[model samples]
Target: MLFGASDSYSADEKMQITVAFTRFGKNLVQRMPRVRFGFVHVVNNDYRHWIMSAIGGSSHPTIISHGNRFRAPRNIAAKEVCKREYATEQEWKNWDWRSEGDLMLNGAIFTQSGDPKAAKKFGGYRMIAYKPAHMVPLLVRWSGTLECRPNKPC
Candidate 1:
């Protein structure tokens, strides 16, 4: 579940996305929703399972992650929750990717970079009222229209 452009990265695209009160898990190939060439606000989501990083992006996308839960997989090497594509550490270290009020579990780590005031710059209006990261499970308990019975047949 990726958002925005794939390779053609540019701020001129003016693409922006806000994901709130959702659940992200069971993804192995990529992040929950990697964005590119825009601003993305990922707030108040449950992340219980993921082989790769929970949130990832590239091409200088401004990622503002707040009040989300990230539970890393058993693999110790895959505990980091932020990944940059097609950029080296020196180049990606300047990207605006900030994580605030997020709950990390099972050695989950978020490599935040760029300016700390970036969130306040992009987050202008308060459209939705979301709970803290600890309450993500309760907020996103029942998503979709189907009965999601874990460890059992749906």
Candidate 2:
């Protein structure tokens, strides 16, 4: 995938995604997935780096972040884990964005909004099972770049 989110899309083309057991390491645009449109469920994972925020979004996307470990970057200003792109307070105030069971570290914060009943409604839906935050290191310890023995078949 490219470093940034781009392209034109229609309402029907929106996606519903589940991000689980993923190792989100150094990258740009907050070093994590930037939700554009549709439903997204981000489950247990290791977040190690970011420039702006961890999980960004726009266009009134419904996002549910749960059980993820967010180790924010050293920059104090970049501690927030959720960033809304090009939207005003009144605009994004009602979008369905919620974070539960997430472990925020180093001042990381996730601003949730909309649908208090969302949890009461969607909380029972366990489409993807994830372990507790402490197990993330063991689950993704071997992830990231694979050193293919320089100049080898890699």
Candidate 3:
């Protein structure tokens, strides 16, 4: 059996904490056992920035699983994309700034760190854009039974 959980975040506010959970049952097939994985799916441009910042700065085994579907309009100047798309400068200020695209997903094997505090130092909006008072935590949790009997499985 496969189990999963999901959550959403807002672009205007820093995501104080985000978590993902998964459960797995013993594999019935003789093929290689599947390991639990976590994914962070971002919808809007702002959400994408936050997620990317977290993944890029994290020391964990996180990686970009899928990229955005929309590419920047090459015909327009690079700086114009945000100004035209967003109504206010404030809305576009904290954005990823580098590229103009939407939709993103980052994946990592769920492994809890002994030091939860380590997350604070990781590269993310909490460190870059927000002040200490506005900081937040992004946590991913994975748990499940593995094919290895009586052995520790990740």
Say which candidate scores most in TM-score.
1
Q: Give a tens-digit lDDT track for model 3, residues 1-154.
A: 1112212222312222222222111221211111112222221211111211222211111112112222222222221111212124443232232221223223312212233333334446532222121111111122335468565763
Q: Could you tell me the TM-score of candidate 2?
A: 0.80
Each prediction's whole-model lDDT (CA): 0.80, 0.75, 0.23
Taking all chains together, each candidate's TM-score versus the true structure is: 0.86, 0.80, 0.16
Off by over 4 Å in 2: 1-8, 12-14, 27-31, 119-126, 145-154
Superposed model 3: Cα runs more than 4 Å off: 1-66, 78-154
Winning model by lDDT: 1
List the candidate numbers ranked by TM-score, top first: 1, 2, 3
User: Residue by residue across 1-154, what tens digits does model 1's lDDT show?
Assistant: 6877566756424887888877775656456778777878888988886876777887888888889998888888889988799899998889999988999998999998999888878655832444788888888888646777889877
| Residue pairs clashing, model 1 | none
Candidate 3: count the clashes.
2
Winner of 1 and 2 under lDDT = 1
List the RMSD of every prediction in angstroms. Answer: 4.9, 3.7, 16.5
Clashing residue pairs in all predictions, respectively, total 0, 0, 2
Q: Which TM-score value belongs to model 3?
A: 0.16
Mind sharing the TM-score for model 1? 0.86
Scored against the true structure, residue 70 in model 1 reaches a CA lDDT of: 88
- For candidate 2, write residues 1-154 as lDDT tens digits: 2122442454622566777777888655463677776777788888987887888777777788878898888888888888888889898989899887888888888888998556544555644665778788788887767668866885
